[model samples]
Target chain A: MKHFAAALAVSAALAVPAFAQDGETKVIGVSIPAATHGWAGGMNYFAQATVERLEKVYPNLDFVLTTASDPAKQVNDIEDMVAARHVNALVVLPFESEPLTGPVQNAKASGAWITVVDRGLSVEGIEDLYVAGDNPGFGRESGEYVASALPEGGKIVVLRGIPTTIDNERVEGFQKAIEGKNIEILGMEHGNWNRDDSFAVMQDFLSKYPQIDAVWASDDDMAVGVLAAIEAAGRKDIRFVLGGAGMKEMVKRVMDKDTMIPADVTYPPAMIATAIELTAVGLVSSAPVSGKFIIGSVLITPENAEGYYFPDSPF
Target chain B: MKSPKIQMSVVGPVLALVVLLVLGASLNPSFLAWDNVTNVLARSAFIGIIAVGMTFVITAGGLDLSVGSMAAFIAGLMILVMNSALPSLGVGIPIVLLGMAVALAAGLVAGCLNGILISRLGIEAFIVTLGSMGIYRSLVTWLADGGTLSLDFGLRTFYQPVYYGGLFGVSWPIIVFALVVIVGEIAMRSTAFGRHCAAIGSNDQVAKYSSVKVARVRLTTYVVLGLLVGVATILYVPRLGSASPATGLLWELEAIAAVIIGGTMLRGGFGRVWGTVIGVLILSLIGNILNLTDLVSPYLNGAIQGAIIVLAVILQRDTRQGQ
Candidate 1:
């Protein structure tokens, strides 16, 4: 029974590629981290919307999108895409750089075009197209905004995301941008980019510090927590809060010119859409879509908040 | 000398908690202030309440890894139900009560499902709960469409008092947490149900021969735990007024850690409610102290917490060996 099952599985695996050769259709497998938080949720939304939109535009393109909850699962997902789907192009927003490197390289070895999104693989020159939101620019844009917002130089606390190379890059960019600007950083702690953790951390920050001029929450989700903590404490000293990653609710507050949330920085989750669209374009058309496409992180204030607001996006 | 040593066994967790308090207060002046103390206690309330239920579960040789995801899933359902009913129920106490009912009902059903699967189907508690954990987490993520399910603004504001407000100087979460602990202590100490759980956990064949109805007792423990998780969610939803996939992440681990640190045996047959409260406080205080001062790198926060939890268990172990 076991031998028969193995033979049946082998034959089924062989049957998939044979079936794919019947048409001029190109298959693009898009792998991403699961929607465990706000930003990833938005990424999932945009990826699905883009996939649906592209399917209508290009009749000969097939798409397989898989969301993994962890790095090992993501690696398996990439492997399955290569083994089962026989994808012409593989678009992946890797969960982590190191573990996913070999799996992505294997996909590349299978003669499939690789579009690495957001997180880059450890090995260089593996991905044919790389699209990512600028982490350094995300931090620099936020730092520049802070420096401009507090021209007179005031003390601020920072709520960082989970510890990672990405977080370190953003913090380094922020510190570099704020150098010589006379802005004093009171403290920095990881909020893990979640609301509850930030809420508790912000409350402790409030208790520890008698007076804080402003807060750089670094992400909109953290900003929401920070703002709530301030409201609960009824602290009037905080002039404004600067949160990045333009969440729809935060962008809406900025659009309305809320005093507490004066402005936001953009680390749009829609970058997933860009990678999927470009991969689709490269598969179907003659457009050269191989190279790094870095989406600049822009500041959203009352003036430009309207353009960044996406009521439909979950984030 | 033996009596004193036996007393010291019970004092291990309390002594550790006291040390954390002193360390926190010494590091920051405001650490012992009423506001800061309340914040820490209120934050611990969610885990503290769940840990109380967890004490019973662990005492009965059962574990529910699904509590965290179960809380998240219940919160999501509560928000969805309230939002959809807002047109008819309106933004008032009726809507808030309705949301609470939904939370309790969902938690009860979820808990019952796990209990039946484990007790009736004769499945291992760990495997059953592990499966339910993934199921609940994924269900919430799917229900929210991979986003956050936020209660309507007006309704959220109206429902805020359940978490933020109190009768005099205490917050609702803290009050609810204290009540649950008191009731849990009584149930675990005086009730026949409690002895049945311990007996079953110690040896199920022996318990059955002793006519304890081991399966019924096991089922009740899970049902009770589910109800308390529901209670915790009632206060939790009002605080954030939203539920996402990130809500209550790793909470089961925290609750389990607190239970084990409080001297409840992971292998079962022993439990403590007040000690679990002390354990919960110790865990929260570690995070609070790490945030209140810059004594160590923020990256070392988890390492510090890990060290303390192990040290706490070791302290209890030494006292047990003395016995």
Candidate 2:
């Protein structure tokens, strides 16, 4: 169960500035998942920071932000916003795709501009704009890095995230990119995007295979687990571990040029801010910001790690 | 007939574990490798250690849904204490020792809170722990700001050996688990306290009539469980070098599941410490074997795990009936 208190804590931070829509002031309701995990925590931080920054810049724009732990709570949150808050526009990062569709569609019927972020809804035409991080690109860039780093070919293992369409897309992109390469994937297993689970999976991988040249831990959290297991095993053969989703700690490692953590890939949670900004622009300006906007996954190398590192970010 | 319940508790889980190991070995020869065996056993340390305490809690007719969250909360506090003290303590043995002391103390306090509320205040264990579960999880989330808390890098290398290090050729976590299980089994079998727990769980009214000090025994069980969780955190943080707010998510369920699968009566009275250890191994082995194979889909793994748990429970039920 999601913490109702945390949801309240997130919304309470941004609920003070109650502004009514008059000449150009538009109320934008921001609904996103609560900080249940590291990624979601980072998303919430960015969402709050962006709202705080934008409210000052656009004096006529007001944001009503609410965080929900589950789909049902999120649905209730949206319905409440549409009914009572009288939101002119809604920017939502759904807790899950299917559950939020009907509620969002209902909001849309009430004339709210729907800006969906990250996970897409089952029904396509309901949203006016879509902003999402590139899942395939995240894997493809990670694959491209692996291919280039081990040009001589090596034995690698994969620690996959949760079994979802996103995971499949990342794996597909990775496989497609490394199709003809000599980098043989000895094994692949799900880490469930959890640190402890990943640690256990990596330990088994280390024991099962005598020689593992490198690792592709798709998510940063799992990458942390993989690194810990490798260290605990005191294995010396591993050249480096590539983890995606530029978590600050991982990025810091890259910046420090740590041997085990050579680089990283970006699957930023700040894409919510992008959605918020676009929706705000659409409401205030004459700009037509409709259609899918996929953020490219950028590879974080030693030289560029500092640019991606956000020390203040919760993640 | 008197030994039948005992046989069901000991023999059943052992059989299930053996069958699983044999099946895994047949599926993949590498699953039987010495290193794989050690790795799987060592990885079970977290759940194994916690399940020891769960044995007491469940035997005393109590439930603790807060163990997982308490682990995370306590782990977070330990990391914070260690990091802040690292500079003054100079990355020495003293800091590590101090961290352990703090961890144990924090666990005892947290456990006592749950125990006192349930035992003294007359609240149901389930309701008390479920409330504390939310409280503990939220506290950790707040502590980490919903992120991660890593120990000082200077000490990370030294602390790594606590988990990764071993005596002679054996891994440390495995050794630790063995020690804990031995101690736990001894306490639950050889002591009057152990008998009191069984008496309390079997029937609180009967235990009270016998002048067993039911509240005191029940409260002590929770405290012991918390201490065990503390020990788990010590091993866990050293391995990961960080504690995320998500560190112990849903671990309480796994611990509870291990306890039940080990033939511990959920309604109270029966507990098998060794069986609990086997139960934990069974759970870890399931994940390990699944990971080793290419046939099982990742999504299907959860369903498979659920099926095994149900099968184990059913097997235990049948064996109990034979008595």
Candidate 3:
């Protein structure tokens, strides 16, 4: 049934070009990472929804959406879009920066407007637009929340994400935010932004530190694991855990005023929607959408948690 | 000298484990604490349980790359089953039992499918499992709708004890892992099935001429491994009460590495259930110790783990050379 509707939509899109003789149908290709994790899954959901919605709103614009599991596959996807589809614009969330730079540049060389999302290309100026979530703001928002929550400046442990530039930037921003505060970091370890890894790491941290006042899980998935470990340990020293990425369940916990999960920070996966929409506007309209669009991360407290709650979103 | 060398090779994994334990204890005062000890052991349970079954499969000259992905798929299926059944069964033991049954059944079917494809169709074990690996991973991802499949909150709370609670001081996973190891060791050493596995792995044509049912034994090995993966998933689901695309990632490599580290040959023929247990413990301890201490940079954790795995295998290899 769903595929039938999709086929119908494709047919309708094809018919639009025949009637509207004023403008030739423009093709916009969107390339993103496959939904391998919660955030990417949410990103995939939003990207697909945006493409479907935009295809209806703009009759003369057609979209080619491709998801790749790796950098090589992503590069191939872009090359195929440029060569086969003859896309007028390319919206890509690179799986990695270094490998995607050359391919995206090649797309630009083909006279396609290139919009890079999240991770930037290694060499700048190739992309007409850059859309990203504020990594530093993500960490700072989380840190600022922790500071305000524990005004006395207590000791906390941090569970970091995978070792990457994004992880590094977030951690640096968090450290800078909490630098003047009296928060003593008991320990820091990479949970690799995974639940199982964080669970094990948090368990070990529980064994190592007897009086951890709080935890900075840094990601919602890791927070789930950290919370489970702390619950199993039955430790009373930890007051609350601040998780970022605004996953639905965590936001729900904040909404209910759960003490363990007092707050969350937003690094929304829906930023992909923003990127795709801007690129669509550039292709169909005369709007100048050729600048960096960084979505600032916001702290989601209980009062504002309801607003950030995306119950329908998979994340 | 030959006798001593043989003894050393036999005890290589044991020696490596002892060294890690001592190093861990010396580095941190709480490393040997009861809680920390249980934490490490329980954490090792999933891979430990899976590696025991891997021992049988390897003994029978088969390899399974699908166990990890199979576990993920089964967990997803179990969660879906249990969640849907919650309306009728409520949030009690019956619902949990139903979930476990679903897991075991799914595992049985998945394993049987792999067994049939490889044993009946004459496909290579590596190729068959490699194909199933991609298939199972994609299935789980599709089942999850590219997100996570989480068990209902009420059910998760009620079922949490399976993972966190245990008789006496040991967690359930550790208890289950210990039981699996004990049975596995006995099977590998005492049973006719065990001898047949060794025979088949060492030389299948010779074993066939010896009147052993080579195909059945090979199929049974896969079936056992699949069932064990289901058991592992039962414990895993309750821990997080969720399954995602990342669930059980790289677990096959870890299980295979443990099997090899414990003195099981990758090329098949010889196997040891007890050694695989030790291998599981060794891998768990490396991660635990790295997390417990800031001795080296966190970035080098993978490098350090690789070095230790190589060192442990080399220790056994040198002793085998003397034979």
Error of 3 at B306 (Å): 0.5
- Candidate 2 lDDT score relative to the true structure: 0.88
Per-residue lDDT of candidate 3, residues B1-323 (tens digit): 65667766677889999999999999999999999999999999999999999998998889999999999999999999999999998989999999999998998999899999988888999999999999999899888878999999989999999999999977899999999999999999999999999999989999999999999999999999999999999999999999999999999999999999999888778899999999999999999999999999899999999999999998887766753
Model 1 C-alpha RMSD vs. true structure (Å) is: 4.5
Clashes of 3: 0
TM-score for candidate 2: 0.94
The lowest-lDDT stretch of 10 consecutive residues in candidate 3 chain B is B1-10
Tens digits of lDDT, candidate 1, B1-323: 55666665578888899899898888899999999999999999999999999999999999999999999999999999999999998988888888889889888898899999998899999999999999999999989888888888889888988888997989999999999999988988999988888888778899999999888888888898898899999999988789999999999999999999998888888888888998899999999999999999999999999999998888777656653
Model 3, stretches more than 4 Å misplaced?
Answer: A1-20
Better of 2 and 3 by DockQ: 3
Interface RMSD of every predicted model, in angstroms: 0.6, 1.4, 0.5
Chain B TM-scores of the candidates = 0.98, 0.96, 0.98
| Best by the DockQ measure | 3
Clashing pairs in 1: none
lDDT, residue A233, model 3? 93
Model 2 error, position A294 (Å): 1.4
